[model samples]
Target: MTAETHAVRRGSARSHTVPTATGGGKRRDIQGLRALAVGLVVVFHLLPSLVPGGYIGVDVFFVISGFLITAHLVRELESTGRVRITEFWARRVRRLLPASLLVLAVCVVLTFTVMPAITRPQNFTEIAFASGYVLNWNLAASAVDYLNATNPESLVQHYWSLSVEEQFYLVWPILLTVAVFIAARSRMRAPSTRPLSASVTTRRGVLAALLLVFILSLAFSIYETARSQPSAYFITTTRAWEFALGGLVALVPGLRLSEALRAALSWIALGAIVACAFLFGPGTAFPGSIALIPVIATAILILVGDSRAAFSPQRLAHVAPVQSVGDLSYSIYLWHWPLIVVVAANVSAWPSWVRIPLILVVTYVLAVVTERFVERPFRKPRGAFRRRSVTFGTMAASIGVIVTVTVLATVGIQNAVDQRQDDLQEQLSGGGSSSSECIGAQAVYNDCADPFAYTDLVDPAFAQEDGPWAWFDSELAATACSSATVGSWVERSCAFDGASDDDPQVLLIGDSHADHIASPLQRIAEDRGWALRVETRQACNPFRVAAESDDENAARCASWGADVIAQTVADPDIDVVIVSTRGDSGVWEANAATAFRDLEAAGKSVVVVSDTPNVDGRQVSNGDLITGPACVLAAGSVDDACSWDDERRDTWVEDTAAAEGVPVLDLRSLVCPDGVCHAIVGGLIAFSDENHLSGSYALSLAGWFDRELTPIIDGASARG
Candidate 1:
């Protein structure tokens, strides 16, 4: 969790809530708010589309927590005359930390048993960072990131919000302390008979300040949500004022009103709050202008609802089952998200409909267990706080030990895996060039390999492609492409220089995979002196066309593919067009074939590279399971265990490529043999995942490519 800047929202919330002087206990209102927020959050998680704006529940919870905590602190100051910071913090740590640490411990154990070896290190990092309340910043940084797509480690990406809340609590009390001290100093200087326990001076000043903060924060939240929703949603900065809003309400004194007036206000506030919830769905622009309605409405309800007669909603919230769940809401919230993510990862065919009941049952079970075993014991203000503190400190120390042991264990496991791989490499040595060397260049291997040992593609000596390669930021591209001497984004050109305009050649086309082979293909282009030019776009397939459909992105993809083909074929100077793509069905087949036929009539040969077979199984990446690559390599011609296929993809290569009369360059014989193949070729693993060989592996196949490719180029050119 990133540290958030504090302001007026941190003020004591007495003035904003029901007065302490009025003995009408409003536990029912608090219970109702809790129930409403918890239900919304659970429903949102289970079926976000049902209540699209259900995420506002978090904001509501923030307000309630801020109000209650500030109200409690103010009352304590009034009674004791001196605030105990350590005791307050100790209470917070006791209340929140133990269960959190236990969750991490359980996650670590589960991860070791179920998770792949490749992602363990990342999981460890996430666990450590999350344990320390910094997961929000980590997640925000990852949302638009370029690297680590294949082996993203954290199974619990949802903990980012928890981190934000934890960090907020850290500084909030200190500021509250300052407010209390200032109030005390001013009261001591005054000639008053009664002690200024709940003085109007501090309350009014704090409320005014909080009002300013609330307005400014609302603006920031709106701007941030508009520009970067994920960051704004997860970060502490945009969320703090909601909590502060609740605190502001708690600090302000309640208005004296008749029973009828109070009852009327209560109903209005409750109706407004519920109306906001029911009317808005998940699609609502949130943590922005829309949030104010719910926050302010909640504040009003809390202030007014205690005096009113029992409403159905308030009655429901006060029910035993609902109140029990409300008490366990924090634990339920913590457990549910990670459970959803992990379950989804394991079973892609998750029924969204059935998931709600499953979530309710599971969240309830976990929440109950945590409350009984973890939360209840720590909440007692006896020796309980000290004992819980020691227990958490021990758990924290244990985590450090576990991380150390896991790292060492991982090192051992990797070394052993590498050794086995090395032995196999020697046996297959003369057959093919080391794929690891080429695949290493493209940093996409991190997701499938141990990043600690992974090789990068951009040559240190090469000026053009050596810098930082983050996709979100272009500055990273400049850094990635730069070398020892001159670091620049443009005009740093290096090429084979062998391929000239006069030479008859093939044009390779597609997305990043196509882009990846530019260097290796350039090597081939240089050797053969062929005019092989690359025309590629990131994530775009070369043979698709715009569909006359509502899915505009698909339509756009189809259009892009047609344009690429049309542009390539129009250049009569080129002899052939080489086409390759990853996993996608040939939705573009009819349009692709039409464009190709036009090209063939115009006298250009079109060669298609069939999609490579991916690894088949539930394994996330070959890197995660230390033995996954070895298992693939040693599977011994088993068709079921070796080959991967997507039903849609089969239509393109197996059927459409045949129908199109395009000569297919069958690399299946090179990669797969006797119905099975190793992820490793020769001494190095060719692929980081089930498909797409590492840059090194791809480059090593150049000689084999040249052998078959040169003949095709020569034969096609001779005919022309």
Candidate 2:
């Protein structure tokens, strides 16, 4: 949402003064710009393909915020000789917090009633972060976390941009005050016969400081985006440059052009913005050099005077429809995302044609109501909220209530989860129970015996505990040995050292799919007295191929795979190599075959593990990845909602294994049986998310895995 500012009336003549913090008429053109920016963001979220680069709307808002806020700060300093920090902050609180808090409260209520129980804790935590104005950092952390990386879009994910703006609001005023102070001190130190204009000197000082910050921050943004793209996208350090650019524009003295020239530049700048939105997509490395396109365009649009020339961009921007959207931009931004998420999660069966318009219309109506009732009321003068103490107190109370409720709800959910886990453990401990027959593949497509005859298809006690999500706490995730992204490779070697150093050295390599099997492999290595080394990356395969659309990640994956191959071939101690990956992509076959050939040529035996069954029909509701177990827990006997066709298992991996004369260890029976895959087998949750096997389930396969794997390794070693 654009920062709240008083609307400026359109200039009637060319000589009219531009809008400023101290004294100037409103600029309807800027409001139209706000409308345009929010429109892009809304459309992008609704139909991403239609406006691929619509996310740049956030950059537009950032620039607008920087310009307007900086102008106000400079004007206050010029008019009053000192900045009122408390008053400045109070004004910001009054303008932004009421609607934000109202929306947050509504989202929290929905989280309890409509959101999946599996994601309530995370949603609550995000709510707390959003309320505290630190959602950006929270999101930045999640961006780098492998487990959280693919999390469904959060209702409050959009709050990250608001967090960034709020942070800017907090710090920018303080920085300006410091600059003004420094300028005053420098003027006092100078022995001058003639007095200098303090306002001009202060403005110059602030501008110079802002320019330096802009350059440094922009450089950092570029460097960070290259080094860590995910982190760069959300962190404040990488985004400060956008705001600094706006501040620079605000600080410029008497920036004016002829009406014709201004109109021409505005149109070109607007076109550049629309072009960036259409051309860019998720693959684009953002807020780096590429981000310069939109940032610069937004700045130019703001810089061009609001001239009402015929066919002028300003005149078009000032249209009533556009202005209305702009007027409600803040509330629209706050309301739209959560509504989109909620609707998508709950009403996904509704066609996109039906869903998109409904989402927009509902969002607009809510925005109007919130803008009128919530935002405007708090901001009005001579109201109860006008008093700084009342405003601050109300804000504090609102935040306190949100945090308190979130914490209580999280605790209650955790308790329920704990109790459910205890029940599962009890069931497992009771060895010869009737439930054992229905465990694993036997339970699939078997109406002969009821697995939950004694209990429930999904246990009633643990049904609301988010059983599938609880599986994330498994050993594999806790260790974090696998690569999170393309370039993040960490070598993890587990050597039993039970006998001599000459013990059979085994190497496990692949993507996160390989990492999921690491716990069981490590257990086997310790028990069997073997040296096991794991080298895996998220989404990376051991074979050299373009597995991902991101060129950098694909190249890195290829390079990493090549290095692993070279090392495996060179080491005489390496007796066996095991390759595992999510075989969802057929492109992986060629690479797997190549790795197999090279390893066999070096006299090292190879075994390829079959890819596991993903929860085929699962839906990611409201940013939470709903798994089979989660679905079953939510609605008992979901009629194969969580199962997939076992026949569709990745054939390329199997084919490569067959061609290379290596044993292909098909774990399909363990995960999916009788042509159907189930979400929960026995009492254990199967998959963590959609594809990756839960650590608990994988570890539970230790017995079956060991029994099946020993003979193959033994035969291979005897031949060697």
lDDT of each: 0.58, 0.74
**Candidate 2 TM-score, true structure as reference:** 0.84
lDDT (tens digit, per residue) of candidate 1 on 35-81: 67878777776666667667777777787777777676655666665
244-283: candidate 2 lDDT, tens digit per residue: 9988888765544556666777789989999999999998
Worst 10 residues of 1 by lDDT: 485-494
TM-scores for all candidates? 0.62, 0.84
Predicted structure 1, TM vs. truth: 0.62
Give the Cα error of residue 430 in candidate 1, in Å: 4.8
**Backbone N/Cα/C clashes per model:** 44, 5
Q: Which stretches of candidate 2 lie over 4 Å from their true place?
A: 1-22, 183-196, 352-354, 381-390, 425-434, 441-507, 522-533, 545-576, 583-605, 613-615, 618-636, 644-654, 672-685, 713-720
Which candidate ranks first by TM-score, i.e. highest? 2
